[model samples]
Target: MSQSVAARPRSLWRDRNFLTMWSGQALSQFGEQITGLAIPVLAVLLLHATEFEVGLLNAAGVAAFLVVGLPAGAWIDRMRKRHVMIWADAVRAVALATVPVLWWLGWLDIWHLIAVALVFGIATVFFDVSYQSIVPSLVPAAQIPEANGKLESTQQLAGIAGPAIGGWLIGILTAPLAVLATVGTYIASFIALCLTRDTEVVAPRDEHEPLLRSIGEGLRWVFGNRYLRRIVGTTGVSNLFSTISFTMLPIFILRDLGLSPEAMGVIFSLGAIGGLLGAMATPHIVRWIGEGRAIPVSAIGFSVIGLFLPVAALAPAVAFPLLVAQSFVASFTVLLYNIVQVSFRQRITPKRLLGRMNASVRFCVWGVMPLAALAAGGLGAWLGVVPTMWIGAIGGLVSAAFVVFGPFWAMRELPAALEEADADASR
Candidate 1:
């Protein structure tokens, strides 16, 4: 025990390769923030793109997930994840770099932005899947939760910091110039990944394997697990409603409450701080409540806390405070639930199937987001944003019930991967 305690100083923080990869991702996350905000602003402000065209641009960005969400996983399983990530970053960097050059030459148009969005998004799908799959290979098994927590924490930090930096860039230079600034971060990510030594040399997958069959195998593995199936159901439903309500949020704040755009931004920023706090709290909460119990309990919280958003109409005097409080708690619960379940899923899945497993999860959960957004628009128009939000909150309760009343409540720890399954993907 004494020796074990002494040896604990050796961690992923001390690993040069891990540090290199993390630094690269950190730069990418921070830099990417400027462009995400700048791109749409550029279309509306400089390109003179109409509202419909801007909508098309936003739609094109996420359409790739619905297009390749499942197959990307199968393809990722066939190659090295680290290599996939490197290429994704490189492609995004190159695509973003084109914007300023095109603008300078007077060749840039709304179509140019749309094209960039499509390519950037496609690359994002690959990068997101690859990074999640690769983490298990990057560190010791015991450190995976810690690694996830750190990564998530950095992402939230980026979320907070990204907007501030993006806002600063916009004030100093135009949105296109801000986008140009983001290109460096992606370049840094590519370089960091290139410099980091990745040991994984994936075994040859049957090139002749029917693509659909490979996809099916991944879907089967995820849904076959009792815990995973419920997790999928829980997250998918939660996302579905969450999107439904959140899509109409700005309208509620700006139009209904009569707040300024800056005030609205402040509300979201303040709310988002909860996610950062939740990431830091994850490891401690998991230990205190036990992983299995922690998940369902957190699930209950977000939906219940979310009710405050719509219900705030009852007390308009304090509605702003209520909405801010709702966002903070909901962000906390949502982030905590995600980290716990993501780490849980990574620990229990086979390495060969990591790509497919993550892909399938993304496929199921993300597929509904666009649809939910469309639904929110329709419902917000038909029934008003407040009533639609109430509907979404109610739906959240139903989603939470999947795990809140299930076996996880009585359980302590989540299951480890079966010993036989641990040997290989063949299981």
Candidate 2:
């Protein structure tokens, strides 16, 4: 029998390279959270952007995945993933710094914000793709779940703290200057990347293969596989509704509910604790119930509990608690689903195809976000914020059907590799 993650004697915390990567990622995630909160607040307060405009800005931030995601995977596969990540961080730092400079010079506007968000998004696509590819190289395969859990926990912690600090900074320093915090974190992450030493074993390349063909190979690999296809379908539909709800959340809390920035930050921070808890509990849950079974259960919980978000707007007295409850439940379920699935994806894929495989999945999953954001914006403007929330919530709940009724429900544990999966299919 295969050794479980808990039975492994070696700890990830002692690995120097992993620690360096972890520190940088933690700082970076915190910075990202800060900027995540600050950007919408800036658009809402400084430029007085309409709901559609805010949605457009959100759309611009993730639109690069649809544009360059596939080619980026192909390119990263040919180069050192660490170098790609470091450069991506530097580019993002510089792109984000432009906002404060523009704001200080009185040249900042909604258009400038959109342009910066687009640039930052492009850089983020490369960074995230590289980040995912590099982690497997830095640690043993048995420890991947633990490594991912730790990294995800840090991200969740950042989600908890970054917003509170960002809200405080926004209240005092104003939204534009609050962005500088992100710049600092990116710089810190860059230095951490520079310090880390890992010997990358590059996959043998076919120099004659065209980039488009390589991308197509990845698409085929993902879509041709039954397991990956189901994951993609569920995640794609879930992300579409998630973007809709999250895009409108700030508008609901700030404009409709008339909550202060600090209060908003606190609500988000408290809600984020669920993610941290989920990350911590994932391994135990997997060990207890088995990995494949965890996915559908988490999906169900994610769908049912997310309905509370839209309901929060209905009651003024309970809005704060309701939002917090919704956030915790939503974050927990999503993290639980993500850690297990990502680990399974990494294990089943060949190292040569890792970057492309990840990129392909991200393309399918995240590609819908921009369109969804725009749709949410349009819906929010026409139907009002509360009604838009209902649409998103109901849509999110329906997304669970994709998993519950699919092949995943029959899976108890994931297949060890693609070959095993294929063999099973043939039977």
Candidate 3:
């Protein structure tokens, strides 16, 4: 009997529900990568946007994360997560489709682009918060890391291929038409989501309770927990600094380094290979470091690597390669952090509180991304791009100090509650 059990193939292949969600996620991520290329290319090429304007666009996206995160979490808790995902996909499809239409009408402008980015970003927050909350309900706790690893791996593959495709498509059809491809990808994802079959999530029974009260409870529950508070604080500080660094990177590349669009695309694609390697290696990393120790260390590692970007300008020939190295290290470190953090959160969070908790986390962490972008752009405008990048790097170093010095650094094993849950699932 033991031999027979051991002989069974370890794969998510037999799980039809996970398969459906994974396939849809793969397609959605591909579309997202294309847009990540399309948006900046469109701004720089078509609208002749200034550095500040480009930063504004990025800020617009994160602004959505800030504004809608908590409410969306509450809203998600009130409906089936799958339904929320389908609706979010449908909304994104419509938002992306508008780009091609407006471009054809000679009505394309930065405002239109920013609007699309913001709305699509909001929908994405809803989809992501719900998706993260629902995954634990769909799979046993032991499979959580495997599922997240596969998802991260798919994201890396998309990062590699999607930008290459987007770059080529832009070269052939121009930026506006390149966006249409993303629209189609979203439609495919929407259909796939609609096809997903799983046990429906029941909305929590709280009809007499006010929405604000429920939202407040979620906020309290997430922030009230000792473990959750530490995770949020660590992630929020890390993200803020990283955002500042990222916001300045494009400016430093274009204005200071004088790299071309095609060159930047290649650099991004090459950097994506780092994420692929990171994803492939996460399971092993978790085992080696132990999941608890992995999170804070990886978070610190990611922050440390951010300092390398500003140092790239010293040698033009080696600058791009150094930047690529930064990308690789950043991808690896961030993925390691994510796999552990997401799995830990999934294990600890109750099903009823999942949506609100996930959203609240995003609200706090990514909420500052846009502000950081704006500050980087403004500071770069005042101090010059190189100086701004130096400041950003310094900020990154400071960010790491918080998590490394905190109590989180000593977490060398799974929490007691989570270990018990994992044991239960393995049975």
Maximum-TM-score candidate: 2
Two-way lDDT contest, 2 vs 3, winner:
2
List, residue by residue over 12-84, the lDDT tens digit for candidate 3: 8788878888888899899888888888878876897777887788898888878888888888888889889
Q: Which pairs of residues have clashing backbones in candidate 3?
A: none
How well is each residue in 50-127 modelled by candidate 2, as lDDT tens digits?
999989999999999999999988888888889999999999999999999999999999999999999999999999
Q: If both were scored by TM-score, which would come out higher, candidate 1 or candidate 2?
A: 2
* TM accuracy, model 2: 0.95
Cα lDDT computed for each candidate against the true fold: 0.81, 0.88, 0.80
Put the candidates in lDDT order, highest first: 2, 1, 3
RMSD of 1: 3.5
Q: After superposing candidate 2 on the true structure, give the runs of residues whose Cα lies further than 4 Å from its correct spot.
A: 1-9, 203-208, 422-427
lDDT of 1 by residue, 385-423 (tens): 789889888888878888987889888888775653334
Worst lDDT window (10 residues) for model 2? 418-427
TM-score of each: 0.87, 0.95, 0.92
TM-score of 3: 0.92
Task: Mark the regions of model 1 whose C-alpha exceeds 4 Å error after superposition.
Answer: 1-9, 39-58, 98-112, 205-208, 250-265, 311-320, 380-391, 420-427
